[model samples]
Target: MAHDALRDELATLTTEAADAALDDIDLVPTLEAARRMNAADRSVPAAIEPCLPAVAEAADRIAAAFARGGRLVYVGAGTPGRLGVLDASECPPTFGTDPSQVVGVIAGGDVALTTAVEGAEDDEAAAVHDLDALGLTADDVVVGISASGRTPYVLAAIREARRRSATTVSVACNAGSAAGRLADIAIDVVVGPEFIAGSTRLKAGTAQKLVCNMLTTLAMVRRHKTYGNRMVDVRATNEKLVARAFSLVQDVTGAPDAEVSAALEACDGEVKTAIAMLLTGVSADVARSRLAEADGSLRAVL
Candidate 1:
């Protein structure tokens, strides 16, 4: 009876529905299989188009929370969990945000990121425990991600977050899922069924990734983490980034390479500060002070 019930639930999931068009996928040649997979992937963006309004609204809520000194938190399990962690981890280097500003809570902890934690997604109690440990508050924004839109761990986290009065957003691949109903904003991309049937890590994963990317990127943009099209808040932590920093400074300021290098050094390798100094022909101290006065907006400082 339990097996039958589980089978029935799976059959109702959009992510689990078998695609009759790809019925002969296993028997196809390598090139044909690749082409078929690519064709399926192409529909992901279209599926997300209708969800733009919801995604933008969620981003605005997150940016407001950031302004109020609250954090953006992502909760999930399995592939959804890994995607949350991946996006959170990139915030610091990409937008120069503090590590604590964007947090990822995956069921079974960090260990679940690489290898599957058996039965982790089914533990609702563990989800509450994980979220509770984060010191959640009303100012925080919690994003719940689940391809099937019914992961117990993800739903539990959203519930706990809502209990704490935190703003909640849900990203799922199905319309009218429980997680979506529970969230303040529901971003249902509805990327249809997977090519391999029940393999959400394929099309569903792509839609989730695009939505997650938009949320964080737009939030950062709202917070002045970018100037025009440039990632002005980028942290130059390595050889490649350091080179890119010099390139960005020169491109934005139209200063000589040597002048850009000097400005960067004077500003302690801060890209936005260096740009301000070069553009305003001001001392590094004045540039830094002006940046602070303008709330770190490089455009205002220039």
Candidate 2:
């Protein structure tokens, strides 16, 4: 069979390669194999340790852009793409960010999120098309993700972002990947060999998810999305969250439940505003102004 350029390189690797060892193992018991895989997975965090500084730097850049009204965009394919979308989608409910503020671009568009699209990742032009649709600018931050570190679609997106003077970062499992070379800041967490041999969804996926979580969560934290450790800016859309809002008010002010309830009502169930009202003993309007001045960070006002 004629191998694809990407697969050609992948096929040349021995068991020594990070993603090929699993196929060679047969003597181990099923339970033991699973246990070993679990144990091996712990090394993923350690693999990422060296890149924390880079990750933090990227977070700083992203936070600065977002503070200035720029968007954070995540682009990828397969598992990496899905993870990007997951992180971006959570920003709204978690930090009360607008849907457009954080966006995710998959190779085959939204459809690829659920099902694989044939040759979708190979189309470099599609990457630019997606970025163009978003009206990308220098104020934006584009993050490209790929486990093998050689996906054309991801590389194209990063290159396009950089060409437009946008801050570009690439997250990959393999070192020296093309995507890494093109990014302004490249994060390569080498989680050495997959348990299932070339199945990046295992350890590689775990590392990527961890990094993605840090990238966005830390950016939000830097932007004053939380008060102390509590998610003060969380959007209360459901019963559990509404209850959480009341609890947060009580926790921040150490006030009686009745007073907390009153503050929440006054602020229309906005946790940050409710906390500000309870602590400052001011009207909701005044509390809102103070919170706004504080960048919606509850701890800042206190």
Candidate 3:
């Protein structure tokens, strides 16, 4: 696209529009300026409310993919890309999922996470190359995230994902965006203009963060990673998490501390297994077999 055409396209984005009310923002008192910014930030959730159905639908698809041993992949640029990576990185530690189960593909690669890669988002072919590296298959779900919803890199990745028979979802901050038009499920947060003109790193970034959180967290829940709101699949790899695992086992089993500690030791610090053993007063081996039979669902085993 020519510079003028690109500029005109950006001009049409809600995120790029300058809020007239903020024209006098520089002239305001410090507290007043802060209040104005806070007010703008506070409207983000409501803006996202209308997009919940789409987010939920995409999450359902993601969960189904997980059940089939498939993955949920995020593709994006700039702040949106960073948010996707942040969310993807948390899944394994939080839900005990393999790193391959949830993945993030950012434009400009690892270098883009901290430094701006000039013209990276405009490289359509780069997006295809990144997704292709993942060996994407029909069971996978690729979510393209872009604040403007017109990012060529994100659009290309989504298009490529669909071409490979993978499910595609889009998260953008505009109505009827190109990314949305191409995706099976489109989530438009529509958070309105940024406090500073065209600076999508602000409210638009927050909206994408919120949606990513919802998507991945709920997908994990649907995959039986949680047991009645408790993170049963937690990997107790740290002191804090080990403590949490003990507490979880105790809470679920309501067993004496000695028995809980013994069960945990027998289960190799696996909280769900410990809980199953104590609650059912069964051997650790029996608990393990029951959990496996129940598809790792603690509630189902109980």
Give candidate 2's error at residue 302 in angstroms: 2.0
Among residues 3 or more apart in sequence or in different chains, the pairs in candidate 1 whose N, CA or C atoms overlap within 3 Å are: none
CA-only RMSD, every prediction = 1.0, 2.2, 1.2
Candidate 2 local lDDT, residue 249:
76
- In candidate 3, stretches whose alpha carbon ends up further than 4 angstroms from where it belongs are none
Q: For each candidate in the order shown, give its overall lDDT on alpha carbons.
A: 0.93, 0.88, 0.92
Give the distance in Å from residue 105's predicted Cα in candidate 2 to where it truly belongs. Answer: 0.9
**Candidate 2, position 87, lDDT:** 93
Rank all candidate structures by their lDDT, best first, as comma-separated numbers.
1, 3, 2
Q: Please, what are the lDDT tens digits per residue for candidate 3 over residues 30-141? A: 8999999999999999999999899889989999999999999999998889999999999887898899999988999999999999999999999989988999999999
Which lDDT value does model 1 have at 123? 99
Q: Candidate 1 residues 97-128, lDDT tens each?
A: 99999998898888998999999999999989
Most TM-score-accurate candidate: 1
| C-alpha TM-scores of all predictions | 0.98, 0.94, 0.97
For model 3, where is the 10-residue window of minimal lDDT? 252-261
